[model samples]
Target: MKLQVTGSISELLTGISHLSEELNFTIGSDGYPISVVKRPGPIEVKNANGQGEICFEKKIHFYRALGLWLQNFEKSKEFHIVEHPQFETSGVMIDASRNAVLTTDGIQMLLRKMAVMGLNLAMLYTEDTYEVPEYPYFGYMRGRYSEIEIKICDDYAEELGIEMIPCIQTLAHLKEALKWNYSNEFRDTESILLAGEPKTYEFLRTIIKSATKPYRSNRIHIGMDEAHELGLGKYLELNGYHNRFEIMNQHLKQVIHITEDLDLKPMIWSDMYFRLASKVGNYYDKDATIPEEIIKMIPNVQMVYWDYYHTEESHYEKMLTMHKLLVDEPIFAGGLWTWNGIAPNYGKAFRTTEAALKANKKFGIKEVFATMWGDNGAETPIQTVLPGMQLYAEYTYHQEVGPEHLAERFEFCTGYHLEDFLLLNHFDETPGVMKDNLYESNPSKFLLWQDILIGLYDKNIEGFPIAQHYEKLIQPLHDAKGKNHDMNLLFHFYEELARVLSVKAELGINLKNAYDQADKDAVHACSEKLSSLRKDVEKLRLAHKKLWFSTNKPFGWEVLDIRYGGLLTRIHSAEERVQEWLDDPTVRIEELEAERLFYNGIYTFGEEGTLGRNLYHRIVSNSVFSD
Candidate 1:
């Protein structure tokens, strides 16, 4: 693995060496001479005099070449390097606003991984996760990054040849910030900014200025998506009647002016414009059309068509084609599926990202990136999605990359087998079910957190055989416990979670049946199981705490504590109710016998507003014993 390099390639080798110690290289003229050549497309590598000579057109291409060499050497495969990047910018976006602000060390670890995978852009998707000098309550108590920390991150990324871009919400998704008294003057609704207010423009300018000040890249992402109720709230109360498009157009003009003044290029989610223009309220409607007048009103801001749901290549093809009709150059932001629950959905992410990348290549879309959103308290760690990230890198350069090649590259880059890492997705997959699409709705999460007395997901999971699935995962998880220390705790956490879910999933149904039969023996058995399950849940809590603190900041662990602690308290109450019911057969368990329960065809649990609905989507009501 010794090699001699010159010019930009030598610089690339130095950077790669800093990231990975597994790579061996020596500055000698004998073994391998890696050269840089100004080629039009794809890198060229030739073997001469028993030495490997690699040539590339750009520094990023050289990094990809080095990645190929490392993969070949590690896997004991032949050296074959021919890659050209599909997009000019390909990277990962870490959502910092969703309560899991990555520590500086975490950022460095990810940057190192990104460098090894030949990703050239990195975006910290900050909604309110950076220090704004004038706004004290902005990102307050949220572990936001300071200016010094941002500089360190930027410098480190620059050394690795990554363009660290700033992605901040300029319009909507500012619910956390809007909670402050100062933000009351600018709030139009719960989440969006006031469109035509003078104070709103001032707030936008300050936010844009503060966000762009830390990063070196002039490219900024002003997230303007999902502002559905844009001008219908307070703006409606004040301004009588006005066109929604007019409101958004004026708002965009004001925001773009601030970006221009700051010498920054701003990008926005194109969904809002599409949703507002189309007759149907769908963002991904294939035949959705935007009014030409409305399209003309938009400024020179880049449109980012963020699509993470569709799995078909034709869906992306139509979407990208529609996006191209709107703007000359549009960026495509795909999802890595890290926000699903406590684990990464690698299976769904892989298929969706592969299809999206192929569509991007076909449509000649230049810039592309995968978003790792931390929705719902950012429970899932970003490291769990390393396989998906590596896949993005693989598909960016090589169009025909197969799963085997991806797995090998993943091992070479991250020091873990792809199969071992993909076990994270197995917990979500229902056994013997072909198309068990969770659609970002994780059953394991709901089952683990569902009330034991109510058993919302209990009868719902009739044929899942979740207990057997969890039993099978225990040994494999124990085997992978030593692969990555940070991830070891995660594996152990899932194992504990599976153990708890196995019992919790069936406890409610079994307990209710025993109660209806008025069998003392069955009641006693259910009581014993409940007590043991409580102990197991307590152990899972401890493991969850350890796993949370191991890779994430301490700020967001409170959410886990709340959920787990709440479940623990409910279990104690469930035990009391069971004892009461057994002692005197007259005690009423209203939750177990609610009359107005409606079972949607899909969910055996109740519908959206029902007591047995999904835990992640709806808040668990206050305890029945509280009154």
Candidate 2:
């Protein structure tokens, strides 16, 4: 496979060599020199025995050509061609502020993967993760990135031809930062900045100056979305009642002025403008319109319409059309669906992103990006969402790339098959049930975290043969866990979680039935099962701890420890209660003997029906014996 690559296609060959080391290659020679000839449109590759000429109009097209070459070569098929990116700026945005800050090494690995995928942009969506020299407690106790760290990442991204931009909150989503004593003067309710305050603009100046210092790109994402109750907070107390939009517009202009003074172009989330202009709080309202006066009030900042939910192309078509009417050159931000729980929802991400990208292309949109948010605790590992990231890259360059080809390219880039990695998605899906609900309603997460004494989601597993599903996932995941030792630990955790769920789901019903009939033998059997499930729970906990520290920092593991530790204590209490009931017939196991337990479909954070908290609440709510 000896070949000579030209200057334009040299980087492409280097990328191929990084993926597959077996092929021997060279550059800038007479024998089969890979030439980059100018083509009118679309990337075309002419190859013979891995020796070829890549014909591309732009340098960016070389990556797509390289991807096509790798796909054909790996499959032992003929060479193929690809087209230009549908969106000019195609990339992924990582949520670094939501508890789990991605380590620098983890980020570098992703950058390498992104390079092979032909992605051109990356944004670290930081709320308070970056250092603010003036604010001491901005990212306090949260693993925020230092100036040196940011500079290193920027330099690395530049080497990979990726423009790493700073995406920080300017108006809202500053909840973490507002917790500090110093932030009291600047905060408008709890999350928004105080509008019409000179001190607020001073704080914004410090944030903008500190955040934009390390990044090479002059473009900054000034997040102004979801500031619903803008002026109603402290701003109202300071200044007489003014329209919320007016307050928002005034604040935005101030922020833009700061950015302009710093010689930076500002981009913002378009939801606030629409929310205020249409006088509708809903972000996806189709008939929402912005008044020309309000539109004129908006400064020269790039408007980013971040839509992550719509699975239909028509929804995106309408939204994108409306966004274009509101602002020029609107960038669409779709979700990769990694923030759900302990796993990435690849199924939903694929369906929705494909539709969104198609709509973006149809509208002739020039820029788009995918977001991997870590909403609650950032439980899911960033690596788990690689398949989703690869899909976004493929869709950007060539919309018609099928599953098989995408899988091959993914394996070449990441050393893991797409099917093997997609096992993460199965943790959330029920066997026979359609997962039409949002990521919050993931059954596997609920099953894993459900209480052993009172299984709320256990009864919901009617059609889902989850025990068999976990049994089937173990071997393939084990086989795929070759050199990726951390992945093996992760798989072991899920395997132990499945074992616990398999027994826990049935233990409650059996115990209840046995107590009703006063069957000593059945009670003893249930006791034995309880003992086994407790052991499985311990194993799962240890595996989870190991997996967590292996891939992430030790900052966020306390949350897991608290949740799992609570489960173990509840299990022990259940065991003691059941034993006391068995020893003395007079002991009232009334709650256990009560009518059949039913699955209540509830989804709210810190609520009774929520997945993780529900099980704990159930145990406390229906305790037959003292703890």
Candidate 3:
């Protein structure tokens, strides 16, 4: 079908159609391409004289074409898709409830980003970001959205062919409002309700009324996720209330009523709807699933199926099932593919988005939303994923970007864009450094090495299992106890190993300097430094070898199952080993003391001797012990 060429919509689609032959779809006057349900009967294409009902039992080609077209359009020069289209809805939800209230300029920037990605909807979840004078808390940043700011953002979104849907928390994620001392009316209890008193219908009504005043968009998203204390003691105290589901439904229905009164269609997270679905029949003998009850109670209401880990295979299946249930109602599949890092997980996000698109076709899902969650903190640098989001727009709208094209785009998106940003790991700068090595190691020394590398990276090193492998190395050292006569060997082993590592650090700086200098002498100096560092590393290796010789076979046969000891017993073993060393008569007490001090040093001062007390004092203690 040929799109009626008019305004930005025409330009956007025209640029898209130019990129591929399969992007033959047309945007109607209603704002987007009219998605007809694929069936086995006869069909007609507008102006093209094409007629036939296309049966899509498994029309993978057609679905793929649609996804490819989206991907192409995103990469086109006229516009960009800011987020991966398939993973998330073209809908953006901002948590204005938090401290980062939406500034007018920020909202505009978001709109530009969304428009470039072909997004059509936005959900501004606010406690009091925008306020209206009549409503007292509408558009509540300090008071609410001034009529002008609200009009500006809304109109701007409309101009970009996007809709702004205001969101207010009916149940939870309403800390700001509660902090405003307005929670006693809504929160059922203090502990259960963080920012307010207790959850009730009245407070929800006020929030809804306050939030939905400015927007022309009929749709609204009433957030009800993360309500840990769903039913407070007083709520459960109700004579007939047996479960939390009934209480939630009652509050939900009230929200629906409020939305209806405002002539607005309400949308909500499917989480509460799913959680309370089982309890609905038990609570009030009513259909509780939002999709199931759509035609009955709130026919006009839409549901968003949001999954942050959309890259997981299971999540793709879950969304498909959810789409089937919510077929008639507008189901927006929301996916999250970026977090905690500066770069987006392009590979995972792409795969997830592809799955979502495929599912959209399979389960008749019409809308998609890409979500950015502020979980770690606001300083998470979400802007890092903007390029990836744009790539999503491209891939979803258009099928492909060759290596060279993607590389150029990446450079545009990220200042230092490489060719395969999607395939690259986050810390691509450093090589062979794995995470997860710190905790699992038994002796704690090898784990200490992993910790040193992590400090250099200055990033979250929590998930890496590098320490587990280091644990294997620890076993040999631990087993070597009682095999050696010279206790001084162990002391020197650690001290020299540390000194060698320090030399490696110095050599690293010298190598960098040599590269900058680009002179023959500088090159020679770099080579010398590298050679010296290598020798030091060899020395460290020799020290470790000696340590192994002293310890390995002595206690090798005392094999005990660590699991049988439990966590506490395992911890006690380390302390016991230290005690055993202290108690040994043949060992020089001073040398044992010196090693103990070094062990402590390893803990406090990293492998590089950064952050520790004076080494002089520790040596003095050793000398005193020896004398």
Q: Please name the candidate that would achieve the greatest TM-score relative to the true structure.
A: 1
Better lDDT candidate (1, 3): 1
Q: What TM-score should be assigned to candidate 2?
A: 0.88
Candidate 2's residue-wise lDDT over 1-627, tens digit each? 435566554444445454343223343355445656765677787667646667766444665565566556666545655566677788889888887777776677777678767787889988998898778888987888899988988877776667899999988899989988898888898888888788898999998999999999999998999988888888888887998778888889999999999999999998987776564578887777777888888788899989888789999999988888777688989998887776777878888888899889999888888999986667677777788888888888776768897887777666667887777777666464346334344655666666655555545554455667766666666675664433677666666766676666556666776777889889888888877777888888898777766656676678778777877887788888889978997898766754544555344333332232233334334444334
lDDT for residue 386 in candidate 1, whole number 0-100? 87
Order of all candidates by lDDT, from best down to worst?
1, 2, 3
Q: Compute the lDDT of residue 192 as modeled in candidate 1.
A: 87
List where candidate 3 sits over 4 angstroms from the true fold: 1-89, 132-147, 189-199, 238-241, 276-300, 312-315, 336-338, 341-348, 399-627
Each model's lDDT = 0.77, 0.74, 0.43
Q: Model 2 segments beyond 4 Å from truth?
A: 1-4, 9-41, 55-60, 77-80, 277-280, 435-440, 462-464, 482-490, 589-627
Which window of ten consecutive residues has the lowest lDDT sum in model 3?
Answer: 555-564
Instruction: For model 2, give the 10-residue run with minimal summed lDDT.
Output: 607-616
RMSD of 1: 3.3
